[model samples]
Target: MYAGNSFEDEIAGLEEEGLRRKLAALPGAGGKLTIDGSEVLNFSSNDYLNLANDPRLKDSAKAAVERYGCGATASRLMAGDLILHEELDMRLAGLVHQQAALVFPSGFQANLGAITTLAAKDGIIFSDELNHASIVDGCRLARAQVHIFRHCDLDHLEGLLQTHQRGGRKIIVSDGVFSMDGDLAPVSALRQLADRHGAYLLIDEAHALGVFGRGAGLCAELGVKPDVVVANMTKALGSGGGFVAGSRDFIDLLINKARSFIFSTGLAPACLGSALKAVEIVEAEPELGAELLRRAKFLRGLLNEKGFDIPDEASQIVPMVIGSNEAAVEMSGALLERGVLITAVRPPSVPDGTARLRLSITLAHDEGDLHRATEVMAAIALEAGVL
Candidate 1:
């Protein structure tokens, strides 16, 4: 029996650096959560539309279970692809205004497949500096040369494209909405740049789907069609899976060449059913996203009024930088003790010296909830000498 003493040292090192992570066994989802039997205002969740616990989504999941049973049983190519999977594929394509879509087990896998398949060995990938970890990993997995441009800096990206100009494939990838900063990408400008450089544009709408473009995503909202759109069902859609939408030919290429999708099991039927229903609801009530943004603005205003340095981004995610790892952890714990759940985000989730409280505004949080949480946060900051 080998006791890994090296792992023990690594664990101790994490704790000393205030980077150790532990799981909290919360009973359910949504804006209000019970942490150890005490109800708290949950601002740490990513369910921006509050659909995770919605009755309609639950019923859809139940129906899917009764119809298709539990697991996928095998890889999609090995007979696990069901009718529900096909329906979800079409639904997601329509939702993002693409010619086709291919579903994956998760958003991470979707990115791993899309980027690797699109950028060949001779190609180059110019990605945003602050893109999601999944995209970063995808770029690494691909054999293509990857050059990272400054975040949302079009001039830097154009310079990279020009410097690395080649006849082989060129792909520019970015997040429609940065998860940590909660800022939108310049989608329209990126589209123009891709056209000018004869490159393919890929935008991950993981944070913007079901909350932007009347649920069609940020690209659709801006009428800027990228060569490929990568997104997830877990966030605002209130389900579990991922999908990549693009032209029919591009999807076919992914089907043939993407190792992640080729080797992985098909998305589960329950997730497919629930995600389909979530898309339907979003289509029927486009205002749901608008109203959620409105609430976010109201809450941001409240936090700003309390003297917290909240950015003026329109996305539901609002971050409050607390500087040091220990102080951020202390602030999060203080908020939790005061019945507000805002988990602290530290490196490498964020950069060093930028530890923050990542507040995700969901539809479940009302005006009263926002007011009370900010009041509590401001008081805690003052006590900690942060205000």
Candidate 2:
């Protein structure tokens, strides 16, 4: 029904603006990987604890497959609610200090379900501007009056909340740690505002889990509890699923009204097995998150000393904001050529004119690895005129 090459023309426009994307087939895992038959220090992964390939997680998954089989075979409401699912739900809730939890097929689905169910028609939602795309999309689908406050600006949020005094159900949502900038949210302040406004608070800890608060996330670190806590096992948990933790009543409401969860198949058995093991590891060794933070600080200091103007954030994600998409991509390519791999993050993932290279540190890297990576990164950045 459309003219030929319409998609091609759109893609060509993206290419011209340096926004084109392609999948790179990087082999292996962890902090060091083989790309194009050469070994490179990997700085683009979310495996903060390097547990994705751990033998314990793998063995747990294998044993689960043998015992419970591979698939859930139906939605949780149907015949798919296994004992493993219930166990993960309980353990994850305990980890976040919540009374109950519900698992979804993915983190995106969790957000979609929680947000839409919490704030329905005639409701009001106050959300952070820099929240992840999943949260953004959830807000869109909520059918509520959505107000986006300035990123991490509590005053702005309060102003918006004050203006919307006659709300049906008011909810405030934000990311625990912003994915691109790696800055932590002011969870305590946000919680205070929510309490003052009589609003339910939701925090997505997708980036902070297993890397902060001894694996419980930013809310736990700040001693601020929200109405809902959202996170995923795919990242630091080294598995594949997302969950929402809250009071037992709220979780029961989600089970009844969250369309995404009600319709989707239950999470696979392998993911549950591996994630259960990952959670246990974090619980046993709470220092893993602290050690990762220490490494992040070390890396940030090294880059700063080398004349790079990365933010002095405590999180493992380090972003070098380049003004142009072309320049950001060029810097990423240059770094790869020099045996270090940091992905170029461009517009839509970040704001326009703020394209960047996001460097994620993992436990697989050490002081020596960070130092070597810093040297290579500095050389490439200098060549690209970013230093």
Candidate 3:
């Protein structure tokens, strides 16, 4: 409870190691943003469909506020469960082709709730090594026997499952699209393993919702239904909340047992309303998802032609794997100076010596924007010997 400059010293150490973080004042929206008082072409956002400032969503939010006021004054279990919340839950379940769904205040809380509730003590949770921090923490909170398989290594996962088959309530968890590496998990293969090993599978589709599978997600795109699916409305839906979808019984269990859900206040009306409209838009306009994938492929091709270390993928997320923390920070600063807003992802967000720039593409980015961004990034990468 008592410390003398220890917190300051730790922060200074983080600064020295290029691990310190600071918030930038970003005032505007979409691909072009007003960051630090300058108009920059932003590639750092997770708004895959560029719907954050969508007029339709704004109108829906406005209507919701007029009807339901601002905040959810109590928890969902108490007095905060509005009719809109029930409608949203039903619509979300329909979106994922699940029997039921439950909403949380944020994606992190959703993961924490789902994982901790499903895989409790006396369970074995097989997690991907590069799963999101929320999933990592969820596994820890579950207090289960956790086994981490190599990222996307189906054979390794199978081996671990085979060895741990005779266990109590086995669970396999992975990200539909890894946040940092910008690579997709092998959902089909994982599903097969789960089926064979009598284990339940959970896929966190935080980064894959609006940009994949006709706006359903990676699991839907691949025709592999997981036992549990968690997603964030903030990223693809351009709203603020998270959801868990699965069988009716599973969702009911979570509603009863998940402390994060039962204890926290319900999602605000504005977010629920905006997200409802966003889901409708995503489902009604399938072309938006296709266009997002096309842009991602185009960007990957452009960066690859320039000899940057980007993976060949069709998802809207692209990673430029820069090896050093200092180099990543320097490159991020240089890009900002050049009127581009790409973030430098360093250690803890990524593994050691695998720092990167997590470039994200959205429906708002056009051919010209992609060309200009790639040119600037290629030049900087070449100068820094990162290409």
Candidate 4:
């Protein structure tokens, strides 16, 4: 019999590659996780607004937990429908200018449910190649004849639309904000494409919410109307849930058909109430949005001034592409040692040979922190031979 060592040795050979090999050695990430000996600055988390630590949101969660208990005893369809959930959903709909809204356990499940249940049979989905994993998975689950369009490539999208316009049910879907590249989708063009092709449009506003659209999403920011808009409260809302906003009929269709929602337990009162409060904060304190953009611009500029090739964008995500996974991991580790935390994103999060540092900026970080982090990054990059 062959030894298990054979398979182990094969896995060990992954280091010879530049992508997955580096993540294998990544320093600890996440707020609760540590990479290397020091607790790295959290640049990888989706917590964009630092609202996770906001006193108001925390207090809301505490109050709800005290009032409603820790968890829902049953699925929403079976009795988990808390009043707080309805309030949050309605508020999100108002924020996004949608006729109705429905919440889900996570943004991931929201996409899964919305796309799959709504477009399952005889449907064709046109998706951006650079969309988030959840969107890609959702499209897969939809069992649609998924058509891939190049990242933000409106030209390619049009070509696909012309080629498959005969679809019984068709939808064009994309991320409102590309999480890794920190770039905006060509939503305006896509809207035009959807119109031209007679296809419904779905925009996942997970990252865009709270950061763009004055806390709603890019759809509101760009003044574009999609057939559906899905978002997560976890990232910027600092809560743990997702929502899909659309026409009352579309939302109703999802409520009855979305397996992710129908089968899973609903968002607990603690998370729902906290999310409701977070939306209120965004509604009232519009300045937080400007501050977020300002800080992101400032940070990207500092990185560029130090010779790092970061693009100028208002999005919270900033990627510093390093050629090899090994180099990317090393850059993050060295930065951590100097007290600047960054996430080394390697394949399959990114394509092979596109190992990069995914820096997620937040309003919580000040200019001083940016300067200190930039200096550390530059010094570490030079030492690691990556600059």
lDDT of each: 0.92, 0.93, 0.90, 0.83
Model 2: lDDT equals: 0.93
TM-score of 3: 0.97
Encode model 1's per-residue lDDT on 267-379: one tens digit a residue.
Answer: 88889889989999999998888899999999899988988888899899999999999999999999999999999999998889999999999999999999999999999
Regions of candidate 3 where Cα sits further than 4 Å from its true position: 1-5, 35-38
Query: TM-scores, in order shown?
Result: 0.98, 0.98, 0.97, 0.92
Model 4's TM-score against the true structure: 0.92
lDDT of 2 at 116: 93
Superposed on all Cα atoms, the candidates' RMSDs to the truth, in angstroms, are: 1.4, 1.2, 1.5, 2.9
What tens digits encode model 4's per-residue C-alpha lDDT throughout 230-346? 998888888898889999999889989999999999888789878988999999986677688888898899999999888876688898998788888888877766666676888
- For candidate 2, lDDT tens digit of each residue in 1-387? 367569888899999999999898767877788777888889998888899999999999998899889999999999999999999999999999999999999999999999999997778999999999999999999889999999999999999999997868999999999999999999999999999989999999999998888889999998999999999998899899999999999999999999999999999999999999999999999999999999999999999999888788889999889889999888888888888989899989999999999999999899999999999988988888778
lDDT of 4 at 287: 65
* Candidate 2 RMSD to the real structure: 1.2
Full-model lDDT, candidate 4: 0.83
